[model samples]
Target: MGRKLWLTTSAAVLLWTGAAQAQDAATAQTDQQDEATTLGEVVVTAERRTSNLQETAVAATVLSGESLDDRGVFSLEQLQFVAPSTTVQNYGQGNFFNVRGIGKSEATTAIGVGVTTYRDGVPVFPGYFQTEPYYDIGGVELLRGPQGTFAGTNATGGAVFITSRNPDFTGVNGYVMGQAGNYDNLKFQGAINLPISDTFAARFAFNSEQRSSFHDITGPYSGAPGDIDMNSVRASFLWMPTDALRVLLKVDYNSLDFGGYPADPALATNDPFEITANGPHSGKDETARVSLNVSYVLDNGITLRSITGYQDGISVFSTDLDGTSALNNTFYDRVEEEVWSQEFNIVSPDNQRLTWLVGAFWQQDKVTFPVTTFPEGAYHVGFPEGVLDYYIFGETPKETKAVFGQISYDISDRLQIQLGARWSESTSRNENVYTTYPAFGLTLLQNDEVTAEKTTGKLSLNYKVDDNNFLYGFVATGFKMGGLNAPNFYVPASSFGPEDVVDYEIGWKSTMFGGRVRTQVGAYYMTYEGFQVIVGDPAVPLFSSIVNVADETVLMGLEASAQARINDWTVDVGAALSKSELGEFYAADPRIARSGTCNAETGPASPNCLNLDGNTQGYAPEFTFNIGVQYDVHLPNGATLSPRMDYAHIAESWTSIFNNEALGDRLEARNLVNLLLSYKTDNWTLAGYVHNATDQTYIAAINAGLRYAGPPRQFGVNLTRTF
Candidate 1:
């Protein structure tokens, strides 16, 4: 009923406004309704080639740098609210990012994520370091559904593409911005671009932000959780020896201290903003990444490109498992990861009748724990806990390689056919051991390797109804590799297979009222086999392991978005409605370790094991919608004043398949509102904004078997100037 009402309201508003505008346009127009102002066309670069968004058949959300600033989006965590069918959940130790109801679900390295994220055409590290702020960005593209052909492995649900600004051979230029707000929040941002020669240029950008903790800890904690302090910078150099050859190099560094991730037990009834923790807080994450892009154009209009990337990141985090001020009730996790990757691509000219692209990718990832060489006092992670409990030691390394290609043929002027495929192989090895204090004992757990290979592809047919309307449909397949799990907590160590998915999607795009309005509507049905979920004691993830279900899961959804630009006002609306159901599966609640397993003859071992045959996927709400309206008021002095309002609604969703209300297993629906007012001149602009204007308290994520509260209301003012 809620979904129906939301869609009905959206349709009614569009119809009424469109009709009224049409009547006004008819009185002074040609054969078609004409308007003085029209929406600008957006060009998407996620497809390995640049193309107008309105002409592309893929389901995507594109945001420009200015758009992100106008919408008050400073980090990746806030992106979920603006994009349909997207969810970004932040936990104490890590995060879960899902699109179309599939993504990370456990704290383990034995499996792969369903969604893949890329930066500057290179697939970067996932799961950690996601809180890094966005600065000097060119644009971002969120592609929904399987993107296996383009992204290769680890893409079952969707993909994210982020591109930062590149240096040009233009003259020296840059900008600076500073902000101050409530909660002692302060931010500084700036950039500088310089031209070294006629063929070489460089650009540097930096961001630094600090804010007070939202939590009031009553326990003797050694750190401040729920606080924010981070700094990030980037440098890029572009070299163009000739018109046919170009090379770009980018170096990025980040130093982030989130204070810590404050969380309370899922069953806790205390104020969400208050916490009691006895453990030491550790939230220090740092990373360094470099990418090189080189491209050359041939006389035949073919382009050859090679991209090389390297990244190293270390994350240290601590949490209170009990969410209370209990003695010796702390958990600490510290790790480091290094990755090296290379990709090569060949592309035909975009204007050709037969456009095609072929690419190859290779990457090696090494993740390790700081244990063996260092002693108890050095790391402190599992110090007293190591004596009481035990900690896992060693490393998990993986190597992946893939070859992918896509081709599109023009069947006629109004119709086209597209086909794409990818063959991927991943190999992973676990050389880990379980150990207690040296005084206690040590045991070798698992020293093994696993390999998985898959071939995924897609087929699409697009038809142009006219210059103003288009239709498209496609079928695609996606895959995610699997690995081995070390035995722990009385749970046996086992290997899990890869997850697979087949997606069928159809869409329509149209422009009406002489480009004054644009709309995109789409529907998708997907069936993915072997849904993965963590099964074990939730209190102690050391005992938890990612496992696969026996049957295939089904998901079906509808997505729609509309944008309009009148003489002085711009309006945008996006909505998504999806129904997801898990296949036949059953797992005894991890919280209740004493419960027996379920079986057909025995009926049920425990209430939690009763059947998950038709349960909804966790964190996947049935309906989501967002709307934004901004009016630009012109002044006689050649300046502008703009006022904007943005609102979003996310329906209630379950934290787990069990859906036990008594345990607070469900997240309540939330309504978010934001407002911004801006005053702009030729060379300078000032803005004041407020987010979460309602000041509602809600949980944004569930980790460490506890709930993490979302941010509260915040108001701020910022000023920017151009040189």
Candidate 2:
């Protein structure tokens, strides 16, 4: 099946490329009267400055605002299909992101997930608050591999950078958009840009959305419609006090409130009625950031830059996972984080020679997780007599300091080499306590601290095949620091170690048919050591422990993507395949020693299992593919018509880290179709769209004892006017 799909996709690409070539010839002749331009070049701030994507020499995916608008994408979760070897999952209320099949599960204070997120070059949100708000974003950049040199720490797998829209100084502009559709849904969004002076400007934006639930609560409980409300406002000012100095100040705020269903228990014999009703969940996130950047142009053709930033945020969620009739029977979790960082770099200005960037970075963050389980009396009914009632309260504080540098020198016109390295030291302090609970035999109740330091490096070589084509190969090493874990039923103490990976990749990027078609292909081999795994500890009663399972993993994969414009229509297709395996394990801890040797063959729940270590790496799909096509037609009445279709497929996957058993393994593949019809004039535009046209029913997430279903079909029409 995989081979056949690949062949079909290849044939489609060839046909589209041939057709695009033919249209390019005609378009060239028409350009004599009016100039025609291709897609706008993408510029990203991944290296602290705006640089063209093609010259960055990194495996990155750039999504433009126009492209996002055309696809009707409004949130970060919808961007999963745009990048290869990437997946997003929802664990309860928090969102988990994975790159190259490496990510964490329910535990937040662990070294498992190696990904990090940044907003406008500032790190605000911590690992506990991964489900961040997405609003007023100008564009998003996804760096596929490690970004240790430029992105500071915690970017072992990769990094995601979001750039919001800044104030415009050109003129006064604003737009309003509204949508109404089935399921009693309504949405409104508006943005305005104002210019105060030639050097100062500001922009403001806001959005609100509400919808009714699709699931029916037929039992005793009553279910209501789910709703989402989000508001964002931002202002930016550019000040120039001297000829060689420029200061830009930006301030933004965002808030999100969502009431939705909770995770459902596992199905019994395929019975759909076992699912629970949509619950009442509410969450709010607010962030404030300030950045100061200064640049100096020296007389000797050298440029020096300094960037400093500070960020603080608070996130809270109040949810009722179990729709019980008892009052205050809910679960609430809140996280507050503050981060500060600074960097200074120097680069030599030259067109065709050596370019270097050296900088030092320091960052510190403090995150507190206070969880309160209401109506604690109900939880102690099953316990022994005289047991005290209590809840979980934990706080984690982390500090990191690092210095990194990168240098790129052209050995010759056809050959170029780049080298980068970073040295980092980090420390974590964990304080956890159970208040109002009995101290006797309470399992885990203590404070834990861990610290680690490491140095990583990367090397890359690129060879130019021609003006429009290049071949590159690279070897990079990345690491994630170890951390302390909160006391729980399964773990008496934190049992984690630093996770590291060495990746080797070779790829080619080419533009063919007079820049009408673009293609990229890559192959990679990755070796990981000290892989983190979640294990149930028998000594700690009911709690589970996060530890570095004594096992190695080898991953090999191939990825290919192509885009072509055939006349007025455009098409994009991509696919990836990977094979991962776990190596032999040696007994290290006493628990494994008591259970015989680590190589023993055992059942899914056995503690001595070793050969199936790969299964414990949750949410890693072996095969994935995405196909999309869009067509646009210009009408005679100065209107336009566009239709788009996108389909994503994933092979059966193991939902749990232990791979004990597969849930929703044979479920139906996701097929989503979207339609848009729009009419545009000089200053006004109107459009209508039908999202999830099929109204397909599928599980968005499935775990050992829980399942989460996706949203139903929705249709809405929107109108926009610019002044």
Candidate 3:
């Protein structure tokens, strides 16, 4: 069935591409270029060069401003259709990003995922911040496969980069948008650009959104509620102090507060679930970021650039495992994190065939989490005699430093080769300070520290079939440093080592029928070593932690996509297939001797037996595909109507690396459809969209026998005015 669907989709795309080419040829002879022009040309800096999407050698996808606005894609979660191998899942209050079925899962302390996220050319401090807001975004770039040598650390799976609208010095331009939807959802956004002078400019933007939940809980309580409120503002200044130098400074602040329904388990019987009538679980997050970029064009075709940034954020979240459970049964987690980074790079101009970039980066991150678990009716239920209470508090601090360099030489006009390398080192420290009432006799203080170093590299060869066609092959390596686990009541913490993977890929990029049709195809194989897997014992509580269990895994995949323009209509389609297998996964487990009874008052004494085998990696989906179509209609009144449709299919996947039967289940395939309608005049545009139009029932993420359901059908209308 999958193969048949793949063939049908491919045939349809090829037919459309052919039709677009024929139309382009006929129009080339004449000087008439009257098309709706809803799809604008996308410009990207994926390779640090201002080039069209079809001109880049790297396997990348670009989402233009028009597409973003028309689809009402205000967050990274809404960009699933922008690429073939990309999927975003939310676990707990956090987000997990997967590319080609490879990504890290959410945890208090673990670093196995192989992807990195960046905003406006600067890497976000930690990998846990993938859920950052996407307001006032100009475009998004998805670079597939390992990009360690080019994008720095954590690029084993891929890299997602977002660029925001910058200050414009040429003219005064701005836009305002307002939206209202079901569930009493409201949103407002606006941006303004000021041309202070020929050498100075300023831009400011702000957005606010609020919405209510769609699910109703009727278990034990009536009027259970869910709500989300978010606000963000950014201000930027551009100063051209000299003709050869330009500086940009930006400051952004965001705050998100939400209260929502908890994860409700599927009942054995078809009984309606109701809440216990307690307060809803809630999460609050606040972040502030400041960045400065300086670029200097020196003599002899050399340019120097520097990016410096700092981020500070704090989050408080509470989860009620069972909605009918009282508030005392809830779990509370509070986290605070601060990060700082600086990078400097020098690049040679494109005057010669040999172009290169060399840079150095330094970053530091500190995160502290305080977790507390309470029994049911801790506040109301009378404390039983001899009962005990406990709290867990820990802090993790990581520091990273690296120096990287890349150089590309054109062996000939038709063939070019590039090589790059990076040497990086990281250190992590975990400290846990706890207190237990009734003198539980457990250790109250513990500390662990781990450090690792690695050198990653990339090599690529590009062969141009012609100006409109090219083939490329590359090999790259990526690494994620390991860290220590916080001490828990049941066991002492352990340190882990770095995990690494090498990816090999061959791809082709072609602009077939003139410049109106573009297509890209690629195949890749990856091998991993020392893969990190999280393991826990269901028999014993508080045994969940990360361990380097398996030594190897092999992943192979193929991807293809195309975009074309036929008359006033545009179409885009894509598909991906992959298979992954683990080798020698049974060697990591060992039975340990127990020193004391399981219910001993002093807890398991001395050393406890640790079993760490047979764990499947998390968030690796075997098959996924996305297909889209868009068209534009020009009316007699000079107004244009554009509509777009997108369909996505995701195959079964595992949610955790440790393949425990209790935690492992095949997530059935899901079909999601989205539609958008928009009208545009000379200077104004109005749009409406429906997401998950099919109202499918699906799970966004699952772990440890728990699943987080995906959002239901949602429809909204947006109004925009530009001046």
Q: In terms of lDDT, which candidate is strongest?
A: 1
lDDT per residue (tens digit) for residues 570-656 in model 3 = 777777777766654432111232332332122232335332232344556556667778778889789989898888887767665
TM-score, predicted candidate 2 vs. hidden true structure: 0.87
**Residue-by-residue lDDT tens digits, candidate 2, 167-268:** 667799878878788877787777788887776666777777776655554333322324555565666666654556666667766665554444455443
Ordered by TM-score, highest first, the candidates read 1, 3, 2
Clashing pairs in 2: 489-543, 490-543, 490-544, 616-657
Per-model TM-score versus the true fold:
0.94, 0.87, 0.88
Q: Write the per-residue lDDT of candidate 1 for residues 490-597, one digit (tens) a residue.
A: 555577778889999998887776677777888899998877776653224335556677677899888888888867888888888888898877665666544444
User: How many pairs of residues in model 3 come into backbone collision?
Assistant: 13
Q: Residue 349 of candidate 3: its Cα lDDT? A: 91
Worst 10 contiguous positions by lDDT, candidate 3: 376-385
lDDT score at residue 505, model 1, on the 0-100 scale: 98
Q: Arrange candidates by lDDT, highest first: which order?
A: 1, 3, 2
Better of 1 and 3 by TM-score: 1
Candidate 2 ranges beyond 4 A from true positions: 1-37, 218-225, 241-243, 268-281, 291-296, 299-301, 318-331, 370-390, 432-445, 488-492, 538-541, 585-610, 613-616, 662-668
